[model samples]
Target: MANTPSAKKAARKIARRTLINKTRRSRVRTFLRKVEEAILSGDHEAARAAFKVAEPELARAAAKGVIHKNTASRKISRLSSRVKAVGAA
Candidate 1:
């Protein structure tokens, strides 16, 4: 529990930031899901397109501090690999 006025205000700010971060994280997940679906469905073109859209969303999320930069880069790398393999297959 926050006792001082400043502490209470800080708590409120944390709560607000939590909600915003949750939404940002959820948005990133939604984009990732789209890419995964496209990949799973074996549509290379769609997968590539979805990846195109998802890549920037991931980068933006990392930039906004919703996710770590390395995490975003790793996900992008893995997805790009899968997309390339899909094309090869």
Candidate 2:
């Protein structure tokens, strides 16, 4: 029900932004899941590598407003800790 032309344009913009954000979110989740899977498998090298890949993706997601900054930091912190623990063990 976008009556105004501006509103209609905004709706279109929103739809496009939503699709891009969804894809970014999905990519971030996939990276995080890869880290988790590597951790669960007790593969230190793989876990470390996945963490390296996921950390930037999480940060980028935050920067793009797909996720909050603190949440991204917390996730990266926890995953890095877990990876370190695995290395130590």
Candidate 3:
């Protein structure tokens, strides 16, 4: 429970921020899923295109603090490798 007025306001702010962050996270996941689906379906061009879109989304989410910087980097690295392999195959 928030006792002070300031605390109550902060709680409200936090709730709003939480919703925004959740939205951002979901958007990022959707983009990643698109890439994964393209990869699994063996569409190299689609996968590469999805990755291109997802990379910037992931970077933006990280920049906004929705996810960790290292986490975003790791995902980008792994996905890039998989996308490259798809192209090679």
TM-score of each: 0.97, 0.98, 0.99
What are the RMSD figures for all models against the true structure?
Answer: 0.6, 0.5, 0.4
Ranking by lDDT: 3, 2, 1
1 or 3: which has the higher lDDT? 3
CA lDDT scores, all candidates in order? 0.96, 0.97, 0.98
The parts of candidate 2 lying over 4 Å away from their true place are none
Per residue, candidate 2 scores C-alpha lDDT tens digits across 1-89 of 99999999999999999999999999999999999999999999999999999999999999999999999999999999999999988
| Model 1 lDDT tens row, 1-89 | 99999999999999999999999999999999999999998999999999999999999999999999999999999999998988888
Q: Give the Å error, residue 25, model 2.
A: 0.1
Each candidate structure's count of clashing pairs = 0, 0, 0
Rank all candidate structures by their TM-score, best first, as comma-separated numbers: 3, 2, 1
lDDT string for model 3 (1-89, tens) is: 99999999999999999999999999999999999999999889999999999999999999999999999999999999999999999
What TM-score number comes out for model 2? 0.98
Measured with C-alpha atoms, the lDDT of residue 18 in candidate 3 is 100
lDDT score for residue 44 of model 2: 100
lDDT of 3 at 31: 100
